[model samples]
Target chain A: MPYINIQITREGASREQKAQLIRGATDLVVQVLGKNPATTFVVIEEVDTDHWGIAGETVTVLRERARQGGAQ
Target chain B: MPYINIQITREGASREQKAQLIRGATDLVVQVLGKNPATTFVVIEEVDTDHWGIAGETVTVLRERARQGGAQ
Candidate 1:
């Protein structure tokens, strides 16, 4: 099983929105990967803007220049 | 780079313990995977006893049967 890890920046998500994102993302993995939801473990991480970085840039730093809010 | 994903329940962890778990787990990935911390993205998810499951069982469900706790 190719363990897929994801940390989606929950910047503008409402409580419901966050929940949907987590559930949907996990479900997507289950559907695409054809893995059991039980074995297909999913972790929903609510990352801080400052803590999470990519390509040597923090999510917050990227967000300032981002035209659109969400990307992956 | 194999994207290693983990869902560990913070059942018996203290505040400091939790931070260490996140830091240490991430660091271990960095060390073992030989991935740049910048590119070596790590997501430390504090799972609930109910939500996080493994092998068709919740972390809590397994913990009851655990010998000394902390395995992987």
Candidate 2:
């Protein structure tokens, strides 16, 4: 069984989107890795922007900076 | 760099417990895999019982059956 974990920032994605992601991930694993869809597991994790980090800065700060730069 | 994803049923885990899991996972990767803690990513996902499946049955149904068996 192959386990896939998809992490994304908690930006209010709908349940339908999550279901689509789960289906897409499982399909990819089955197609590329030749895994059985029945045994494959796909987990979707939504992390808060404040908790997800990039380059020693959190996504919250990074997004804010990007917004400011774009506005300037 | 190592990425660790821990999946568990949504059973009302506290923030401290999640933090402990993240720290413990990071430490394990550093010790066992000799991975850089800075580059290591640990994500904890709490899934609804209705979503997680085993033996073609969801955890919600499985737990209910177990509880019924225990009561009999």
Candidate 3:
């Protein structure tokens, strides 16, 4: 069984969005890896801004940059 | 890359314990499937008692019963 764990840096994703993400991710794994969807498990972890750091910048900082269309 | 997602019904396991569990679990997976540990990603989700329900009982209830030596 292949288990795929995805960490979403932003929390507060609704249940419906979560469901779609799970399905889409599972499908992607199946298509790319040819793994059986039944035995493969997909786990999603909603992360807070404090839990993630990229390039010495926090998620909050990244979001701010994105909002200002910095290097999109 | 094989990702192993582990869901623990009870939360609050220390970092050391989590490390041990992840190592042991990865070893088990390697022993059983001959997979490389380096490429295997192990993610552990510590579930709150309220998030888990088993056999009409919550994890809290199960822990309470287990403490009294109900079952081994």
Candidate 4:
């Protein structure tokens, strides 16, 4: 069984979008790797802005800086 | 930051169980990979038995067979 996990910054993702992602990911794995769709699993995780970071700065801080037009 | 995703066959996992899993996984990643817990993300996904399969048999079928004492 092939398991695919998708992580995104906490925001709003409609249920339909999640369904599309799951379907597309499963199809891609089946097409590329010949995995069975019945056994393939797709999971989506939403990471909180405070818990997600890049360049050693949490997303919360980065967003705030961006909003204030501060230097990167 | 390290992201950990755990997949399990859905049955009955309490919120407390999931919390412990998240905490333990984060700690393990920090100790082994030296990842920062503040940015580390741990997510758990529960897959339906029908959606999880091994050896071409779905977990649902396997469980039913086991309950009936059938050959694996």
> Of the candidates shown, which would achieve the greatest TM-score relative to the real structure?
2
The lDDT-based order of candidates, best leading, equals 4, 2, 3, 1
What tens digits encode model 3's per-residue C-alpha lDDT throughout A1-72? 566666777657765565565667667767888877766655566678877899998888887888998774
- Candidate 4 lDDT over A1-72, as tens digits, reads 899988887778899999999999999999999999999999998766654444344566668998899776
Off by over 4 Å in 3: A65-72, B1-6, B9-44, B47-72
Q: lDDT by residue for model 2 over B1-72, one digit each (tens)?
A: 998888898978999999999999999989998999999999887897655544334556658998888652
Tell me the number of clashing residue pairs for each predicted model. Answer: 0, 0, 0, 0
TM-score of 2: 0.55
Candidate 4's C-alpha runs over 4 A off are: A1-72, B70-72
User: Candidate 3, residues B4-71: lDDT per residue as tens digits?
Assistant: 88797666789999999889988987999999998988998785553333432345555888998988
Task: Pull out the clashing pairs in model 1.
Answer: none
What would the per-residue lDDT of candidate 4 be over residues B1-72, giving only the tens digit for each residue? 786667889898776566667667777877888888878766566789999999999999999998999776
Question: DockQ order of candidates, best first?
Answer: 1, 2, 3, 4
Per-candidate TM equals 0.42, 0.55, 0.48, 0.54
Those runs of model 2 whose alpha carbons end farther than 4 Å from true positions after fitting are B1-6, B11-45, B49-72
User: Largest DockQ belongs to which candidate?
Assistant: 1
What's model 1's overall lDDT? Answer: 0.60
Q: Candidate 4 docking category? A: incorrect
